[model samples]
Target: MRLLNNLTVRVLIAITLGILTGYLFPETAAKLKPIGDLFINLIKMVIAPIIFLTIVLGISNMGDLKKVGRVGGKALLYFEIVTTGALAIGLLLANLIRPGDGVQTAAVKGGDISKYTEQGAGMDWTEFFLHIVPSNAIKAFAEGDILQVLVFSILFGVGLTRMGELGKPLILTFERLSKVFFNILSVVMILAPLGAFGGMAFTIGKYGLSTLLPLAKLMGTVYATMFLFVFVILNLILRYYKISLWAVLKFIKEELLIVLGTSSSESALPQIMEKLETLGCSRSVVGLVVPAGYSFNLDGTTIYLVMATVFLAQVFGVDLTLGQELTIIGILMVTSKGAAGVTGSGFIVLASTLTAIKVIPVEGLALLLGVDRFMSEARSITNIIGNTVATIFIANNEGEFDRAKYNRVLNQEAKNELADYKY
Candidate 1:
């Protein structure tokens, strides 16, 4: 019964059942997409409010404007360096593996790439920056615009901090309200199994497993590259700060599973923030870093964008010069940031990058239409892990992390696992 009640176990079971259902009853499983969509919608309803409150509380509680600036600066710098490396690594691996080589482009079906191309072409860096500051805060929340809410939250929190004693009652009220929303989140998470089930079912049913056969090589390369990026590159980053990568992974296993099942990292955003606090990251760091990381620190997405670009170049027999490859990296560094809060952003960003480079045919995107869903799980999982690591690293660097609390939490987790094992 305890095993049955375990969320991780239940989610695992749900994924298996979902896959089986999708494979066996493709039409019915495809219809189950709404179940997953509804669950995501339920999570989304709480997301804006939670982000607003958390950022407000974190900044107000910190009481140091300079520290906030320092934290944000450090996070942005870290995001740039790490994501650049991810882009380089993806390019390197794509060249080495040649996942797109010897592909019969004639045999593969291409989809309508016009809308994505249009979105990509229309994406403007200046407008993206301006969009961060919501003209109307309420509108930002209503639309679930994360970056807009983030900007508003920071400004509100700063104002609250400056107000000092005048803000005490409001702080208390905010704290209480935050607790209430989290309680609501706890209730909502009970439906995660259903969401995971439906998401997996729909993906398998609609795409079908056979869609993977032709693109299996590309899929394999992507998964392999991500695995190395996590265990090797990310592990080294943690080791530099004397943190245990394995322990951190163990701590957030549930969030990782949720991301894996849903193929959406945002699904686990709020829960991961709460868990990071429990694992000893300060509220201020978690607040400032996690949301921003979602936008700027997309290591997984960066890798995919580069790899896919190179893969297409190979498929179309377009030999990119060394200078052009560098340009691809530079352009992606900017376009990839546009992914924040955008649905189907991976393709949109890719389309924009291709348009900018003018070497790879944008039509090649159609070839990936079938398998992008399958690869999304890898991207989402890596992204969440990357963000969690960023929060922990930044917290420790700023002396905001509580080592005692971290050790205590890990010890308790170990004890619980041991007890469950003995059961």
Candidate 2:
């Protein structure tokens, strides 16, 4: 029972064991890739509904229906500040470390191009944004169109607010339903370590050590940047708002653990939503801000995209020239936002970016592909911090956050204050 409670420890062990298995027996690990895919499918199965339920409930519960606009402004503002800092850090790292200059990628030229080429067509910028609005909401879920699901959730929530007293029963029902879905997500999270292990094993088996290479440089830069963003940057942000970063983390410990293992921030959404609302953030603020954040506020993915593209270009002896670097940023700005909040989204956005730049060989993606699973942990962690901060900051500006409630609910003595609250 104690071991089950220590999700972080279990996840660490899983990652360690996975690396060992892949290192000792690459072929077996490679063959076991489907296990990783199955794990991803399992989590993805719950995400759309989780997003919808949380957003709808979160919005419906706002004390006043009109606060949504103030919430949106502050939330978007918060996202911009945090994400810009992320982008700057990524750029700074890329410039300083020159992650690409050292090595020669011998096998990069020979991977099967057929697998990537076919998947990349018709993936233009216009088509990407267009896909955000679903032709049919149900079909969107079936197809994993997260943005569309988000759009539907927001509209539904707004509809609820507009209906006033007539919608109370339905709103109450959705609020309960969101709680039920979150309970289900908690059960699913028990598999996180298994998912992480399988995914890491597949990564190692596919790429091997030769693929990721002298990890200290690139990995260190990314990990360091992520650490600074959360600890240094977000710590300041939280402090400015008279909140405790430690307390916020303590509150979301379970969700943080899930993101660490799954490497998919989206997987942690329901839990984050539940925890935030419990922390005194108005539901409407959380609803609009969080889903929109998933689409518009991808600080982690964007930073990684910038750093990785530069790293690849530098490694291949290609000069990005000042103009091209900006071009890369411009491309990333759009593509990373287009990324849905799901596992493997970073890779898809990276693929899109790679396709756009024509600077590095798409084959370079194959290089990172090997270590991508490990890297996902970093991206996921950054995303978690970015969103959590965004949610709170927005709530503060709109007067939607009950600072007094935050203090009370987050106080150690008030541990179960929200235990009786409706979902």
Model 2 lDDT per residue over 264-371, tens place: 776677667778888998777777787788788887777888888888888788877888887887777677777664335666677777887787877776666556
lDDT (C-alpha) at residue 109 in model 1: 62
- lDDT agreement with native, every candidate: 0.91, 0.74
The deviation in Å at residue 247 for candidate 2 is 3.3
Clashing residue pairs found in predicted model 2: 58-283, 100-314, 100-315
Please report, as a residue range, the 10-residue window in candidate 1 with the lowest summed lDDT: 104-113
User: What's the CA error at residue 254 for candidate 2, in Å?
Assistant: 3.1
Superposed Cα deviation of residue 418, candidate 1 (Å): 1.4
**How far out, in Å, is residue 411 in model 1?**
0.8
Q: Name the candidate that leads on lDDT.
A: 1
lDDT of 1 by residue, 133-193 (tens): 8999999999999888888999999999999999999999999999999999999999999
With a 3 Å backbone cut-off (N, CA, C), the pairs that clash in candidate 1 are none
